[model samples]
Target: MLIREATEADWPVIWPFFHDITAAGETFTYPFDLGRDEARGWWLLPPPDRTVVAVDEAGTVLGTAKMNANHHGNGAHVASASYMVDPAHRHRGVGRALCEHTLQWAREQGYRAMQFNAVVETNLPAVALYRSLGFEVLGTLPEGFRHPRHGYVGLHIMHRAL
Candidate 1:
């Protein structure tokens, strides 16, 4: 798979998968029916954010990620990121590669650590990946996310020193 920085034109291809994942309301805390323009503004090109896409040999987007600061001022040295893979492309190492690339990019940009503030506790695969990548479950906020089907689930705060 090829991993590269995303450009403006890539949003059209990225949006459908984004919409599908967010609509599922299984992992992210975003509103289930979040609008396209709002998603574009948040995930595509927001300031202090860098979006990237992973594609196969034929250029089919397998997944996407957005990396940015976890917070402001004193917390800006710690990077934060989000990932989404097309359901059809699951279990092919796309998410792993994207996470690795994001870590590398963050460190290259001088970030001291990487934090994921709200990882749904039900997303075992993602939790496992982060663990394998050396992230620790700093803590979990009880009933932090309201999953559509499994309401009142916990949210994990995961972090890894860069």
Candidate 2:
């Protein structure tokens, strides 16, 4: 597999899984009925911010990630990132590769640390992956996320120094 910068053309392929994942209401906070244009605007960030895709040898996109400042001005030194892997591609290291790529990008860009503002506590795979990558749960906001099937669950604030 190869990791490379994402392009506008990749949105069409990404939308299917992106929509499926968000609509599941299991992890991401995006509205279940989020539209394509709105999602495109949110995922395809502009310069200074970065978006990338993990593709197979045949060039099939397996996953994607977007990284940027967690906050502006005085808070810009800290970075944040989001990842989405094709459900069909889970457990194949797609998510991990995207995360590793994002971390490298953040470090190269001079970020002092990386923080995830709203990680659903129930997303065990993600929580484990982040932990394995050296991120720690700083705290959890109790009943912060209203999971579709699990009712209210905590949202973990995870962080790690670069």
Residue 136 error for model 1, in Å? Answer: 0.6
Candidate 1, which segments miss by more than 4 Å at Cα?
46-48
User: Once superposed on the true structure, which residue ranges of model 2 sit more than 4 Å away at CA?
Assistant: none
* Clash pairs (backbone) in predicted model 2: none
Candidate topping TM-score = 2
Question: Total clashing residue pairs per candidate?
Answer: 0, 0
lDDT tens digits, residue span 1-162, model 2 = 999989999999999999999999999999999999999999989989999999999999999999999999999999999999999999999999999999999999999999999999999999999999999999999999999999999999999999
Angstrom error of the Cα, residue 110, model 1: value is: 0.7
Q: Give me the displacement of residue 20 in model 1, in angstroms.
A: 0.8
Estimated TM-score for each candidate: 0.96, 0.99
Query: What TM-score quantifies how close candidate 1 is to the native fold?
Result: 0.96
